[model samples]
Target: MTTRDTTVAVFRPDDERLRDAVELVESLGATPVADPMLEVRETGASPRTDADYTVLTSKTGAEIARETGWEPGETTVCAIGSATAGALREQGYDVDLVPDEFSSTGMVELLAERVDGARVEVARSDHGSQVLLDGLEAAGAYVHETVLYELVRPEGAGGSAELAASGDLDAACFTSSLTVANFLAAAEERGIRADAVAGLADAVVGVIGEPTRETAESEGIAVDVVPENADFDELACAVVERAAPTYHD
Candidate 1:
């Protein structure tokens, strides 16, 4: 592996998770460009209790649901990923279903056969993909979505984009499609969208999963790393390894 110094850009929310991500990058001997692209705005809403199935797509949604007194009394609870499941369990909600793939497509696939003709309530951020709702509807289920929160780009969040434009970004870990969109928007705001994209082409770009990868690719970003499991830690590790491939004898 190359021992050369690496500077990686991370776009996690400005919270504990961001700190953890920066710590992970440091442990891998890379300089971290800590920029928060997503900010959570709670909508003060909760899942309806009448649904036959309840879906939570993110950790923020689960946390907000718990905060808003959403008790899943007899409702078959589903989570999009392990982190969301863990959040539900932490709040004393029993998670009954977790898709193997950990994405909207995965959730729809997991419930397609079983949720036919059933009432499925999806409670999540406003940035959720229409694919989930359309897939569930096509599978013959009645789907209702409640926006638990909204994910917005934090103000003045494109410093990393400028760094990337200047050719200082060695890698970027994009955890979601919205983050990719937000990053580009910030870059565009700074009038450096083209330069930033060009710079990113010269560096290793890693996305959390297929959905994120698709979004990045659709925007002309070349994705170099996608971990088998769609989680932040796994994504981060894979990207770091790509930035400076693992050494061997």
Candidate 2:
């Protein structure tokens, strides 16, 4: 008999990213469950203008910074990843540095040699990692952070939890640490937390990168795939390929 159809769950915001995720799943010949786990709340805050170096960690942060008309001026600009760099460029901001690896650790590594005695401004979300701040400080830079946005789980999430609990899901793609936490929160709200976690143990669970994988595993969710590249398309493609190997158009 033909295998059952593949169904992949994605937890992106309820914006264009989710739409793109749905289309990507469809293109991969798997049914998409678009359950947004996180919502963006802009904080109306921008990075300090007097920093010798400035770091932005997300596309959302970059967009918000540009919207606030925050100029980089003479500050050396840094991005955590290519996506953030691209966002800065699209917002008419020139980016000076992007780490070879797209992570807090990578950002620290890239700046560890140059930021001695410099004033560094890190502007991102409320969930910004301490690793970045601590590393910069240890390297003799005075690092300050501004919260550009906060990520809160949307109200009507967790549909995918039900699907997973019932064994209807083939795979899941988690993009960030917050997404993993919010997904569990949604599952708990639906009273299927245990079952959902058990079901995921049997399914192909893909996370975007090391941090997300650590978050998932810390929650007792066995992550099955993590692409070398820390991006959605890479995560989705790797998950879909594993979940729908025999799927035909």
> What TM-score, over all chains together, does every model reach?
0.96, 0.97
Off by over 4 Å in 1: 1-4, 246-249
- For 55-125, candidate 1 gives per-residue lDDT tens digits of 99988888899899988888899999999999889888899999999889999999999988999999999
lDDT for 175 (candidate 2): 91
Q: Each candidate's lDDT (Cα)?
A: 0.90, 0.91
Clash tally, candidates in order: 0, 0
Q: Candidate 1 clashing pairs? A: none
What lDDT would candidate 1 get against the real structure?
0.90
Give the top-scoring candidate (TM-score).
2
Question: In model 2, which regions exceed 4 Å deviation?
Answer: 1-4, 247-249
Report the Cα lDDT for candidate 2. Answer: 0.91
Question: In candidate 2, what are the lDDT values of residues 1-249, reduced to their tens digit?
Answer: 122378889999898889999998888778898999989999888888999999999999999999898999999999999999999999999999999999999999999999999999999999988999999999999989899999999999999999989988889999999888988898898899999999998889999889888899999999989999888999988888777667654
Candidate 1 accuracy as TM-score: 0.96
RMSD of each: 1.6, 1.5
